[model samples]
Target: MTTSSSSPTVDHAPRDPADGRWTPRLVLILIALAWPTQLLAAGGILGANAIAGVAQAFHTTQVVWFGLTLTLVSTLLTPFVIKLGDLYGKRRVMLAMTALGALGELLAALAGSFWLVLAGRAIAGFYGPFGALSFAAVRDVFPARLVKQASGVMGSSVGLVAIVSPFLAGWLIDTWGYRGVLWFLAAATAVAFALIALLVPETPRHAFGSRLDWPGGLVLGGGLTAVVYALGQGQS
Candidate 1:
């Protein structure tokens, strides 16, 4: 009797080592992280066109503050935010940050006063380290082999966003007017927030009751703020 040879079976899907299940949520989180930088950079083009409307509604200084406010607040809060993520969970912190950013953009879109817009921007500054948090999440959730490739993808996306944002912002400004920039940012932020809330899972946290260096974080935040402030002022 002749026996037929059996065909080799192939595995179709890769598994995540952390949980033994690969997830599409990692890509979703990366896309969410990309939005913040793109939104912020895109809004820069609105300066010439949007500034006039803002000045008429409020004042010229508000225009300058529009650009400065988010950077300043983000510089001050980044360290504390990272520490908070370590203690609690990066996914939780990232979701909170995304929520804050969305709220800020919504406030900016609706605000009738310059001070309110500044308030929105300050809250929006929470987005600064989202990319880093996302990278950390990848490290925590993905195997070592995938981490490097995933990180390269993330880095490349930033460069791509840098190229796209200006033209997109300019077109929005030209089409709908200045508030369009804020509206677009708000919409993007809201969508990102939703994706994070729905798909991303909380990663492992630091050991329970670990000591946190609040003082060092504070100093770093303060020094960074000062440096950013000086640079922003020098640009004027």
Candidate 2:
């Protein structure tokens, strides 16, 4: 009798040696991811708390634009940034965005006019989707058994930041004024950049074959901006 021969199967997925245990590297990676997630959550709180100081400094009632610009830009860019992370490597894209965010924070801190501060906030919005990126990175790099735990830690970080940021913002606003708040954010984002750069690994899988739908993104962003702008105006 003749026997048929079959080719051996190969598993190509990325592997970690410490798949089943909590390793130091894993903890560092979690911290790297969670810190930026915290910063992103904290930004809204800090902005809201510091609005009066911003108005006083610039002597303009249009301080509303500080929050509005950030919200609008974040709404517009989050999808594009996420798609870019999928197409390119998540770590690389995340670093670039975080660096841009730090620069924006610095700009806002030093800006002499309200318009420049709004422009800075618009730039800083590039960092808005960082938490989503961190979650995707966890999926990409963590072992199957560790993903649930890692995700739980990431989700909990937001709650932690929410509880702490209001108090932190209030103190900063009291001590150094609104610019101090921006300075603090810039420093925190820079630390996040360093952590991610040093510890987080790039995702092995990428959707290089996929194409970005720019037209759809533009239409959606424009519609959302219009609606949000109208609502914001209505509130005033």
Q: Tell me, by TM-score, which candidate is best.
A: 2
List the global CA lDDT of all models. Answer: 0.70, 0.85
Off by over 4 Å in 2: 1-14
Q: Distance from true position, residue 121, model 2, in Å?
A: 0.8
Q: Mind giving the per-residue lDDT tens digits that candidate 2 earns over 1-236?
A: 99753422122224579777888888888899889987888988998999999989889978788988887887777777778787777888899989989999999999988889998998898888787688888888788899999999889778888999999999999999999899999999999999999998877436665789898878887788788788778875
lDDT of 2: 0.85
Error of 2 at 168 (Å): 0.8
Q: What are the runs in model 1 whose C-alpha is more than 4 Å off?
A: 1-53
